[model samples]
Target: MCGIVGAVAQRNIVSILVEGLRRLEYRGYDSCGVAVLADGMPKRARSVARVADLDAQVHETKLDGATGIAHTRWATHGAPVTDNAHPIFSRDTVALVHNGIIENYESLREMLRGKGYEFVSQTDTEVVTHLIHSLYAGDLFAAVREAVKQLHGAFAIAVLHKDQPHTVVGARQGSPLVVGLGDGENFLASDALALAGSTERFIFLEEGDVCELSLDGVKITGRDGQAAEREVRNVVAYGGAVELGPYRHFMQKEIFEQPRAISDTIPATEAFDPSIFGEGAGAVFGEIDSLLILACGTSYYSGLTAKYWLESIAKIPTQVEIASEYRYRDSVPNPKSLVVVISQSGETADTLAALKHAQDLGHRHTLSVCNVGTSAMVRLTGLSFLTRAGREIGVASTKAFTTQLVALFVLAATLGKQRGHLDAAQEANYIKQLRHLPAALNSVLALEPQIIAWSEEFSRKENALFLGRGMHYPIALEGALKLKEISYIHAEAYPAGELKHGPLALVTEAMPVVTVAPNDALLEKLKSNIQEVRARGGELYVFADADTKIVNDEGLHVIRMPEHYGLLSPILHVVPLQLLAYHTACARGTDVDKPRNLAKSVTVE
Candidate 1:
């Protein structure tokens, strides 16, 4: 994924571009660059290092301009080199920063070559920049409009032309783009978070929308080159989500904040209200008989955990899919099924595309469980359950995952009531437990010291296996994912019942098989699975129920979960594992928040 920020103001915008790029750094970038229109030319500085390095370059060169476009690249078209960084030029008159792929760039590049245009970088972005410049007869806007017509794939682009010194042009087809409204200035960025401190007013660009940002205001043009009126609304952002106040890493802070985060995610009500999801949520739940969840990475595991709740509590047949695979594969879609999309940013490329793909197949009843209300997922869905996880800065996704589980469980229980599966007393009991979840999480947070002690052993291990049964199987998968992502360890998860069939072969004395043992009906089966691992000379690190009979002996190390929450057990069990991964990653001296090759949000496919 890449981050783009553009601004046109009366004052020099180099600092604004740099500050915006810093805000977008959590999205992840390897190289950064900026191009500003000053003295009737585009003054540009690029660096293969961090944004701060780019800022240093700007300071050294004294780059000054009123209109500028900056980019933080993840390096799609070429290697992570200075030349491959963005602000690829078009004859010094046109400079542009682009996110997403241009599928027909080779053909376009050859066509540009026919017109005697030469390229300096091996980037598809460069070809488009050159193409736009070549088409510039008099107006930059018209040239950009013509150039975009020749493009073939997804893009969110911000272009700066010397001819239009007071304007920055932005175009989006299949990527996230938004315009920030400010006094005597206008801004464009791949995300609204980049414009957080500057302005709260945002204009979310729709698909195939193009906009021109000037010092005065913004002008929009639709895909057909016709004028369009776009509404600008105030969308407040999570204040200081990137700041690691008093915590070593965001993962650690987020792990500790689980109690408050869960409390915020779950409403403080004596009884569960179906309307908590939104107006007519009960009606939507009443109509849908089945569930299909589309998500990726940790969000997929959240959906997997929800499957257990939806089937057991709501009696709805449910299936979960990795969003990337879901869009490409042919599958039967149920008209009455609720297609749920889970994402924190709500801008995940695969999930967004899959959400649309599901809709294309006549699954119109769509719901999204997301954190960002201004995200594409929420905008595209018919219903939404917005989590109060705030902005999850950690690339490993700690609080977001748990909060997602909370939202999903709420959906399940609400559906259960609507389906007549949960009686009035049962619903009241679950609601009481839900209201008490924050305190339960607080009790579990106290187990962090024990988790930290267990993490010391994990830091030394090269490989590990996480095992769980029933609903906790997804928790096992998520646990292994967190460890592998942050600790740089090779880890895998298996449903405990599948152990003797295959995964047991890798269970050795050196391999630590972490288990999530909740006091559900499957606990006996999970205990049997643990015995099998122990019989094979495998060391076991388990987060078990407080009253579980399994004791710490020989090679078995146990970290007791404070309680066993029936439907919401996964949310509570995940916190200790998060603490485990964070502390282990710290012990291993790995980047606990910005893990290598991992972006906080996957905005590109």
Candidate 2:
């Protein structure tokens, strides 16, 4: 995934474009580039560094224009280099910025080369500029439509032509592209955050939709050249919502926001109304004999947590599959199987593909648990549950993962009740506990200062180990992922009970061992695991509940969490680990929001 931003008829728009790029940088930031139409030609500046470097160069050179397109690349077809950055130009006429992969770029490149078009950068995006220049007939929109027709695979493209300085044309298929409406100017960005300061009114382009933008307005059309009407949506602005809000990094803020996110995710009583599930979900769930959970990354871990919940609470045999690997496997799902897909973006490529594959295999009872309402996964699935985590900008997921877990837990409980596996008292208890999660999360949020202090020790640590038991094991894996993603720390997660089997030998004083030891059935075993590490001279950091009876003596650093969370301990236990990763990244002086070589969405397989 890469970030694309375009503005038409905007004066001194370089700064605005750069700001938009900064906001969208979470999408991709391997390199940055901007193209401005000046003096009847496209003036392009690009660098293989952070956006700030390119912004400085543009300011120092006084690159000025009204209409422009900028991109922060996450290399796909080529390595990160100045020449490989976007907005790729063609003979001073057209400039293009692309966000998705072009599977048939080699064939297209060969055809273009046969037409005497010489390429500069080894990027599939560069092919678009050349193709547009070759087919230019004074109609930029028509040329874009023609160029897109020749391409294959997922892409969200923004094109700017020197001849049509006041116009910017874009097309989307299998990638996110939003149109932001403004006065005397309009915006095109991969996400709404890019245009947050400029406009709140947006139009989320559907697949196969094409649009042309100018200072006046946006014109919509379809791939078949037919006029298309788009729905204008009023996006609720979460102004400064990305800010830490008294926390450290957005990760830490998001970690603490999980409790509220879970509370928000609890299905309304109206959802239990017979009219909502239609003739009751009993008939639909009754026919299901098995369950499949498909997801990727941290969402995959949430699915794993859900598998345990559904198997234990609902008595439904469940399987958790990583979406990328799921689709390529020969596994077969029966007609009585209920396929559940989990995704934060809901646009995650592999997860969406897995959903499609399951649907193709004739499983119509597919359900999607997603954060975004209009996501591709939502559109494709027959049934859906929405998690209201708002917007997650940090590349490493925090609120989204916890919200997904909450949604899945609710689903599992609902299924248990419908299947006669859970009694009224059990369901009521779960709902009551769910209601108190937000407040319990607030208690965990209070641990931020202590976690930040712990980060100082991590700064000197070259490697770290995360240990947990039962449901907390997945959380431990997630914590390790966060540390490695943002802080570049070599961290690994191991089941506390399995440490003695192999990983215990790797423990040393130089390595910090973070343990998730809530008051669960496995607490005693986890305590012994902690002692095993401490005896090996390894530094110990424990995130335990208040009544867990864990001692804080001798190389043991304990951050007491709220006591007696029961099954909801996973939701609370992840907070300190999230803060640890966030503060550690900050201590390491890493880009806390936009991690290196990572994109917000994996739109490509």
Candidate 3:
């Protein structure tokens, strides 16, 4: 996904737009561009690399204007080149910055070419500009609406017209768009993070909603030209403390901040009272026959962990599916089913699509556990639980996954209590354990140096195997994903008991086998799996709890984590794996923060 930002102001706005682009650079950094309305026409400055390159060019040849749009692209439809950058202009009149994919752009481009609409860039976004120019009828908003009507797929567009220099129009279908309120100025961005420095009040535009913004105010309207009303929400700004502090990168800072994030997420009895689930939640759990957990990427691992919790702890039949594949499948959910979608950026494209599909299939009860408050998934779901992970910057997801598990654990506990599967003592005990997770995580983080040393061995390895069982199986999957995502290592996760099925054949002295052997009900079986690897001469790196009597033998690398409550061990076990992945990537000299061809958020399908 790309990032889009636009500002309509009474004063010169180029600096503000560039600053907004800088704030949004975490969303994407492949290329950056800006278009400003100047002298009754649109002027552009763009580059194929970092924003600093474009900033240098802009400084040399200033394009002063009061209204403009900017974009930092992640390059979906075309190659990452200067010509393919955003701020795609239409015959030097209107400029557009788009943040999503245009699925029908190839056909639309052919038709537009036949109609004598010349294009310069090989991007789906360029087609939008040409389509708008071909359909202009004195109203840029109307032309944009009509242009989008003829197209298909996800997009959040910010269009500026040279003829109407004082105004900017924005619309969204499947991607995220938020309008920020400012004094004698207004802002448009793909997410709240881009506007956090300028505004706290925002309007979250829904699907098919169009908004025209000017220095005076903003007007909301629908695709059919009828006026629409939108709710203004207050966003808490991340102040100066938002910097990386003493850490080298945001990823490292985030990894170390997990303890604090966990502390903030787990609520006390007075704050998050158990009685809150006494209403419709109880009724829903009692009446619901089955459960479906839908998610993508790291969130999918969270859903898998939730499936184990729901099935074993709450005694509910649960199914976990990758959101992209779930929507296209032929299976039908029962009418009494509860669908739960977990996401950090709740705007994840596939997850949102799956949630919509479930709604369309007549699933009346749905819930979203997400981090963002006004994301599409949260707005569409019947209920939502916001995870207080606070702006995860790493593409591999460290804090968000743990927070999602915390939220899912809470949900599981609620359902278990409702169905009489958990008594008051058990519920209270789990809640109390949840409260101590932050401190336990703090203890686990102290082992980062040890894990980093272990990572040095992994740099020479070509492949690795991650093993766990039950709830820890999801942690194994997440660990493998993190390692593969940052280090380019070929890694796979298998349930400890399923090792003999097929994966055991891959074990060798050259391969490193990572086993999650935290003390649990299945620890003995996990030990057997480790023995199987050891017998095969596979180098073993075991993350074990301190009290667990796991012997340190030859060819075994052991890192002892502080003994945490069994239910909270997953949260602690993930820290060392994160460190291991980080150090492995560092040793291999890969881009740890911004991985190759991967954006932080998947805002496009």
Computed on alpha carbons, the lDDT of every model, listed in order, comes to: 0.89, 0.84, 0.85
Off by over 4 Å in 3: 239-241, 270-280
Q: What value does the lDDT take at residue 99 in candidate 2?
A: 85
lDDT of 3 by residue, 39-106 (tens): 88899999987777888878889777889999999988779988998889888888999988999999
TM-score, cand. 1: 0.97
The weakest ten consecutive residues by lDDT in model 3 span 270-279
lDDT (10s digit) by residue, model 2, range 1-605: 68888998657788878888887765656899999999899998898888889889998999988999999888988899888999998987889999888888988889999999899888988887888888889998888888889889889999988888899999998788889999999989887777877888999888788899988999988867798887888886543535666865666666767777777887666233222222434666778888899999999988877887888888999989999998999987787888889888788888887888888888878788888886778767767788999877788999998888888888788788777888888878888888888888888788778998999999878899999999889989888988899899999999999988999989998889999988888888888898899999999999988888997888998988867788777878877788888888899999887787788878777
lDDT of 3: 0.85
lDDT of 1 by residue, 391-420 (tens): 667788988998899899888888888888
Between candidates 1 and 3, the TM-score winner: 1
* Candidate 3 pairs with clashing backbones: none
| Candidate closer to the true structure by lDDT (higher is better), 1 or 2 | 1
Off by over 4 Å in 1: 238-242
List TM-score per model, in order: 0.97, 0.88, 0.96
